[model samples]
Target: MSSPALLPLCLLLLGLAAPVLAEEAPTPAPETPAAPAAVAPALERSQEQQQALMRQLPAEQQKTLQAGDESFLALLMPAARAKAAGTVVLVPGDGESADWPNVVAPVRQQLPTFGWQTISLSLPDPYDPVVAIEQDTAPADTDAQANSEQAAPPVTGGSGTAPAAPTQAEAGSGEPAQAAVAPVDPEAAANAQATRVLARIAAGIDLALQQGASPIVLVGHGTGAYWAARYLAEKEPAEVKQLVLIDAREPQGMPPRLDATMGKTDLQIADLVHAPGAAAQRRKERAAQKANKGYRQIDLPVIPGDRAAEQEQTVRRLRAWLDRLPPAASGSPAAS
Candidate 1:
């Protein structure tokens, strides 16, 4: 009914009014379901009773467990939170059944109090994704036939030192080795592959240093101690700070050459041999008939033959060692 001239004016008013109203009433935002909160791992979710229930269940029979302890535990020690001024790598003893978790739990529990970072490294599993580490390689100096003749090459000085005689089985001289084992070359063919492990551990030490650590202490349990010693003796003699040998598992004595080798470096050796009473003293006496350095017999009061006892015994020994060590150098990781 409006005139044509008025039509343009009305259209302009409608456009302006519509925009104002539209501006006032915004379109409802499309409903978005809030992202589901990231869930904690099953183990963290479960109470202690639940964790016990999980252990009782056979792996085949387990009904979709929420989280297994080991896998779930990955959350605890992420790289950011893993800064440690000192580290304790708990190396397990030789056995078919390598109990990694049993070693980790107690240390994990105590590590934070001491302001330590603990790594429970799984020793190389043969089927592990890692490269196949050659146990002993032929020396470059020897010819193929000569090398073949020496299956397990005896260790010789590498870094500017004199070579020594290879150890023969102790029984040969009309007596068995101190441990009553046939002396298979006293030094296990140096695993050139373990050289890789030491490299990785060295990287870890470098990382700890990057973060804030002063001295990263190396604690080798059982035979692991020997490896640490050998690693220090052979490879980067200066990389390591302190060495704690829980109990050497070497069936034969640590080759005498190791002391002479380590003596050249700044390495200090401390031994907490199995047990250190009269009977153990005899064992110690017999064991020492072969060593060149001081071997302290660390007495273990409690023998944990059972799983529970083993856990307790390990904790007791570590605490005792920490308590017994003399005051360390100022501002050093060993100071703790």
Candidate 2:
């Protein structure tokens, strides 16, 4: 071959050989992603706590009741005497168990002796359920990249001032994608709590009726009073004839006011106001006055340093009030 032609052929051969050499070099394998760690399911705070509590209580007192989608615990003490006086469903306040020591425990234990069948319910915690979730921490690689960028000398322009690296908005646009969770709605959470509480209360009442007990009276303590009153005013169950509220306070941040709720029903009502200065206003409220001729608001003196005595005194007053009512009008579960 001539020299110029031979040179051209050699260049062509090298070009083909270069691609063959590059293809022979080993390529790195892709990395497999790490598996996600297991996460526990979210649970309602009150239900979880109460389930643990129910295990410690006596089996005899424990009653598993179902209401709507929820199953909850109730403590029942049948009438101590042969002749049943009546049934009283006790609804405890927020942060209290069915066997709460203060008013609920004492009343449920002692009331049966006075010929009353008592059942105390566990109320849900008035808050949104906590979700068990894992947050994505900033990737270690991201931090390393950020640090490397910060440490590097900026690229310069002809003017000598370094060209702008990148605006914050521009840099953020390339950030790795993350999980997006919507914020919980407060109104929806509150409504769910109210519905759950009301269902539990109704279940307790149904249990009493099933046992063939009559003259079912709903007694609510603390915020529970609001739930009980609201149930009565709304359901107007023919079986329940009276309501007793002890140290009653409406559930915070929600409601038809307790007074307005009371006004909706004509059932016999008693407001056992424990807070000083509350009795007078509760007495004058048009709701209470218009409720039934039987509505009465009585101020209770707090027995400081003696919880037992205070509970005893409250029970005594309740017993006396029951004695005043005419015999439960002929709606015994046995007769029905």
Candidate 3:
């Protein structure tokens, strides 16, 4: 119906519109895979717990110490009387806090009444879990069972032609091949932990010295004893003249064992052990006594379910031991 020139123009406009429409409708970009979320370190959790505990403590008694990038909690119980015997640096064992209800809290609270200042520290949790979780069946075992069933030939009602037996290659390779496991170096981990713990101990010693405490004593409970003994053996600070261990035990992955750690140190040590049938612990104490001239061992009766009695007896024995140490130089208080 239109003129010949108009038809050419219309064709040109339609061709232009077709190209524009094609350009507007482009393909969508591919989605990127999300990165795995970073996990919080185990130490962070312990620090969080420590912070919560610090909130519950009395402001006057609470103390915060900075060791490297981390801050640790310490509780200071000043002497009830004017003249303090000396400051006893208390390091709690694994799973214990600065004011743990067990021996740690009791000792820290009672020692001050006897004219001794107590500084209790909150130590880190064990690197490994104390009890491993059990699973019903391992993935590898399940896969192995499935592969064996698949490899077995099926039973037939009537055997016209028996199924061909599986080839040796197929049978041997049926189970998924296991990947090689990486080796772990326990000593390296222990050494790293020891380094951190030493820094904290040094900080505590500095605090004691600042308060004019003389003849500082390092007291460690359970695994903490190992740390105190190891620190004394390695650093041998002149200010810290004595070490006391209560219900002592070695930490996991630490080398040289508890007795060996105590034996190597020349510092005067009072090794106290409770509970029955502790043949191994007693033997180790004996070895340390034989090796070190200043080593003393005390066996206390374990009164289960009677925490007060146990703490009382322990304090009594410890007080007696402290009394026996050669009197400190004139004007210098002795360590308890």
CA RMSD, predictions in order: 25.4, 11.9, 12.0
lDDT of 3 by residue, 262-299 (tens): 65667677878885346446645666557767777788
Q: Model 2: per-residue lDDT, tens digit, 1-336?
A: 789889989999999999999999899998997888899887666677677767787788888999897788888899988978888999998888887787888888888998999999988777533331111222335554554555435777787878556545347666433334445555666678778888999999899988776778899988888899999888888788789988888776675688778878887777787674553376447554584687877777689998878888888888888767666442454435
TM accuracy, model 3: 0.67
Regarding TM-score, does 1 or 2 come out ahead? 2
What TM-score would each prediction reach against the true structure? 0.44, 0.72, 0.67
Our tally of clashes for model 3 stands at 0
Q: List, in order, the clash count of every candidate structure.
A: 0, 0, 0
* The 10-residue segment with the lowest total lDDT in model 1: 66-75
Compare candidates 1 and 2 on lDDT and give the better one. 2
Q: After superposition, how far is residue 19 of candidate 2 from its true place, in Å?
A: 28
The count of backbone overlaps in candidate 1 is: 0
Model 3 ranges off by over 4 Å? 1-45, 129-184, 276-291, 329-336
